[model samples]
Target: MQALLNVILPVFIVLGFGYLAVWRNWFSQAGVDGVMVFTQKFAIPCLLFNAMANLDLGQSFEWRLLSSFYIGALSGFALGVWGARYLFSRDWQDAIAIGFCCLFSNSLLLGLPITERAYGSGALTANFAIIALHSPFCYGVGITAMEIAKARESGGRASFFKVLKAMFSNAMIVGITLGLIVNLLNVELPEPLGEAIALIARAALPAALFGLGGILVQYRPQGDLRVALYVCVISLTIHPMITFALSFATGISVEATRSAVITAAMAPGVNAYIFANMYGRGQRVAASAVLIATGISIVTAWIWLTVLP
Candidate 1:
């Protein structure tokens, strides 16, 4: 109960404020767009930049830890695709889009904040490690799967260059790449510039949370309720269970297990819908899944926190 109150509900309360403001016509969709642009394009990138710049790569980047988390993610994607195609009777392109909803967890907006609240800021190094590779990896798999699906549908070849261009063009990926260059080369920013970035980084979470809630206003649970719930089951339950079992089997540290499981436990991100919309496929299912799964995760995350050590 304390975890629900202290760690979970506070985040949701901030999110709720954003939802209520937008729903009541007090906050314009334009304003929500601006906030999302600031957070996704600038502030959160700065946050990732600073975290990556200062992270001890040798200590944090464990193969076991990464493998445990990613295997679960990949499993979710496979299951999502298979279920959408076989059970729900969606076409290949739409199935791929729905699979992406299971693939991309809301690592930044939900994972970082929730883990930080539960375990303290010092425990975030593993989360950062996971996130550092997250966007690139998820986008790589999603774009490739989508391209292949499109190719099959059109009886044409999938474009490799197109996939690379799309993956590298992401602002988050650019920020992460630059941060890696700095870390690898031991480049230090000037103090004033560092402080300025720190200022922006401080604003990333709360602002992103608010913006996410406002954005969720646009993705109401309208259609494809069964398919949306299928996504929720995979994202909130099965993914984390797989990660937890693997973590225990591999005997990684408790902290790594916590990071892996909690991150896996988050709902599908807005990128799920963006990817679906980009392909003009499964838009309703993806959008509905994001909203419904996010609401469900309130209880689910608290349950995971209780179970984790």
Candidate 2:
């Protein structure tokens, strides 16, 4: 209960404030979009850059830890695709978009903040480690699968180069790549520049959370209630359960297990809808899944926090 109150509720409260402000017309949707743009493109990238630049790569990037989390993510994607096609009768394009919802957890917005509050700042190394590959890996899988699906539907060849181009062109990937270059070369930024990055990084989470709330207000549950709930089940439950079993089987440290399971436990990110919208498929399911799963996670996360050692 204390964890729920102290760790989880505050995060949701910030999200709720954003939702309330938007719904009540106190905050314009345009303002919310600007905040999201700043956070996603600028502030959050700075945060990742700082984390990657300073992280002890040797200590943090454990293969077992990464594999455990990613395997679960992959399973969720596979299952989401299979279920959407076989069970729900969605087309390949829509299935791929739905599968992406299961694949892309909200690692930045919800995962980092909740984990930080529950454990502490020192406990974030594994979280950062997982995040380092998250955007690239998820986007890589999603775009590739979608391209292949598109190719099959139209009887054309999938564009491998286009996938590569899209993956590298992302701002988050750019920030992460630059950070990696600096880390590998042991390049130290000027003190003033580093401090400036720190200042921007500090604003990333809170601003992102508020913007996320406002965004959610725009994604009210529409049609496709059943399929959306199906996505919610896979994202909020199955993903974390798989991570939990694998964490113990692999004998990772307790902290790594916590980070993996908790991150896996987060709702599908807004990127899920963006991916669906990008392809003009499964937009309703993706949007509703994001909103519904986020609400469901308020309880589910608390439950997982209690379950985790």
Candidate 3:
């Protein structure tokens, strides 16, 4: 109860404040969008780069932990895709979008703040690893799948190089790459540069949370009730179960295992909606999935936090 009140509640409070700000017209829709863009393109990358640059890479990464977490994510992705295609009779693009909602999590906006509150700052490296890979793996596969489906629609081949180029051009990927290079080579950043990065990174979480809350205020779940319900179940329940089981079976350190499981349990990310909108496929369902999953995750996150040590 203390943890919930002190840690979790504050997050939602800030989120709620954002909702209030928007509703009260303190911040216009354009203003909120601008904030989100700044957070994603600048603030988040700085935060990720700082985290990756500072962590002891050799000691931080455990192959078993990485494998277990990804296996769970991939499994959920596959299940979501298959269910959308066969059970829902969705096309490949829409199915892949749904799968993305299942696999991609709100790692930046929600994961960092909640985990930092629950497990302290030391737990961030694992979360960083997950975030760094989130865009590349989730978006990469999603774009590729969608492109292939589009090609099939027109009787042509999708370009693998195009996918690679898109992935490489991602802001998060650039941040991750630079961070990894600095870490691997033991390159020390200049004091001013480091401070500037840290300063920008500091605002990422709160701003992101605010933007998310504002988005929630706008994106109501009015699509197919059944599709929304399916997304909610897959994101909130199945993802966590697979992550927990795989982490336990792999026998990573208790801390790492716990971090992986909890992070995996977060709601479907807004990125899923962004991707869906980009492709002009299943945007309504994707929006509903993210909103519904976020609403439900409050309870599910509390449950997991209580059950986990």
What is the C-alpha local distance difference test score of each model? Answer: 0.94, 0.95, 0.84
Cα distance off (Å), candidate 1, residue 78: 0.3
Regions more than 4 Å wrong, model 3: none
Candidate 3 per-residue C-alpha lDDT over 119-216 given as tens digits, one digit per residue, 9 for 90 to 100: 89888878777776778888777888888989999999999998998788778788888898899899998999999999999998999999888877
TM-score for candidate 2, residues paired by index: 0.99
Whichever of 1 and 3 has more lDDT, that candidate is 1
For each candidate, what TM-score against the reference? 0.99, 0.99, 0.96
lDDT of 1 at 245: 97
Give a tens-digit lDDT track for model 2, residues 1-309.
Answer: 998999999999999999999999999999999999999899999999999998999999999899999999999999999999999999999999999999999988999999999999999999999999999999999999999988988899999899999888777888888898899999999999999999999999999999999999989889999999999999999999999999999999999999999999999999999889988999999999999999999999999999987
Residue 60's lDDT in candidate 2: 93
Model 1: lDDT of residue 100? 96
- Candidate 2 residue pairs in clash (backbone atoms < 3 Å): none
> Can you write out model 1's per-residue Cα lDDT over 1-309, one digit (the tens) per residue?
999999999999999999999999999999999999999999999999998889899998999999999999999999999999999998888899999999999999999999999999999999999999999999999999889878887899999999999988888888888888899999989999999999999999999999999999999888899999999999999999999999999999999999999999999999999989988999999999999999999999999999998
Which residues of candidate 1, in runs, are more than 4 Å off? Answer: none
**lDDT minimum window of 10 residues, candidate 3:** 56-65
Which candidate leads the pack in lDDT?
2
